[model samples]
Target: MEALLLRVVPGLSEEWQGATPDEIERIEQLAGRPLPPFYRWFLSRMGKSMGKLTYPGLDFSASRVLTCYAEKRITPEPRFLFIAYNSDETMPLHVFYDLEAPARADALVTWGDTWGNVLHEGFETLREMLAWGAVLSFRVGKMPQQCEGIITGEPVGFLSRFDSVMSRLGFTQPVPTGPYCRLYERPDAAMVCSSPSAATFKGGQAFTLGGVDEGALRRILGEIATEPSLEVEVDEWMPELG
Candidate 1:
């Protein structure tokens, strides 16, 4: 998986890091069964760190605390390992591995729009998802290298609210880049929302802002900070994701 990601998307290796043996064992113990070979290989190679490919998008925990916050926050069955999720607020798409299936290198990947809505089954391998995620991250990182900022707030409704404000500003319709993210673009600026990970939920979700002039950025920040129910901090800097 590491070689594939590097080959497919260069410059990402800097953000990648391998997991230790102890970390792998801890995850397997949590699943109550050994993970698929491909998945274990992923953890061994790129589990601890994946740059933009993961961090608020396709977020797989380095801590490997396998828990799923579905319609209600309940413990998932041991056979179902909830590995990653988009925003818990908007269109909560989730990815998991079905341990009950015959063990294979690729594993049976499942996509759930909500808790029970299985939109796709056995549709993609863990490897494929990771590779695609890397591409998306690369594109996001390439956002206009002008003045950048981030809106940080509660994960529950932050992205939804941010999209609304951007839409009203005529930023154009949001394009779903991945299960966890949507990109909104305009002639002079662009914005993307990244779901909050377990590690950063308290600080809130990072809504990346770029490609706008100082005046435009100020206006955008005012709209977001004064919006109906959102309390967010507008930091005039891009988010740093490992």
Candidate 2:
């Protein structure tokens, strides 16, 4: 995990300040059980800070998670240990460990929102979730080197439709529906598409393309933006820079 973390976000070590033993103990007591080994290791090593690699919405920090539960802002569930919560409130996405399951080094984790919607179940471990977030942080945090674009037309199914089109373009959906966004990746580049939830009607679909050269980014954008299934105008941000 350490190797993968460093690989995804360079200079992360300098920013990582782990939690103290007392802090970890307090959290464990709150949980009424020991945290999964991998998560405990994470708290002991990087709970204080994860720099840019810390997932945007999920609250993996020991102190924050404890506060959320201790203060009763979000009531804890029976037989379900909450590892991360939607601190950003961009979406209700939260992750938890099933305490009733058999004990192991890592617990079975579920992805869901505060509204009791299980976005995904048991598809990722604590380590894998962190790793995926690292990759996304590394990609999305690339900044002005990337392109931001908006799709015109109806917003419903925009992100899912974008995912479908990108998948056909050789991109794979590594993880689906985290913080109201979906991530698609390929060898040379990665794209993140996000839309307001079906309940919200404020914003349209937007995406960011990074880890690719300007030329390739433009070409790929042209391909997807022109696809008949996604009938929308892509206002590429790459042009103003040139």
Steric collisions counted per model: 0, 0
- Model 1 agreement with the true structure over 1-242: per-residue lDDT tens digits: 46536744667678777778887776677678868888888877677776546647456754543344423442556766776656667666677776765333655567675354556563335664554445335433555443344555555666667678778888764323322344565666655554432334443445656653456655766877787666656555543322
| Consecutive 10-residue window with the lowest summed lDDT within model 2 | 195-204
**Which 10 consecutive positions of candidate 1 have the poorest summed lDDT?**
173-182
* TM-score against native, each model: 0.47, 0.55
lDDT at 75, model 2: 59
Q: Whole-model Cα lDDT per candidate?
A: 0.58, 0.66
Top-scoring candidate (TM-score) = 2
| lDDT accuracy of residue 31 in candidate 2 | 71
- Local accuracy of candidate 2 as per-residue lDDT tens digits, 12-50: 888888888888988778778867787788888888887
Quality of model 1 by C-alpha lDDT: 0.58
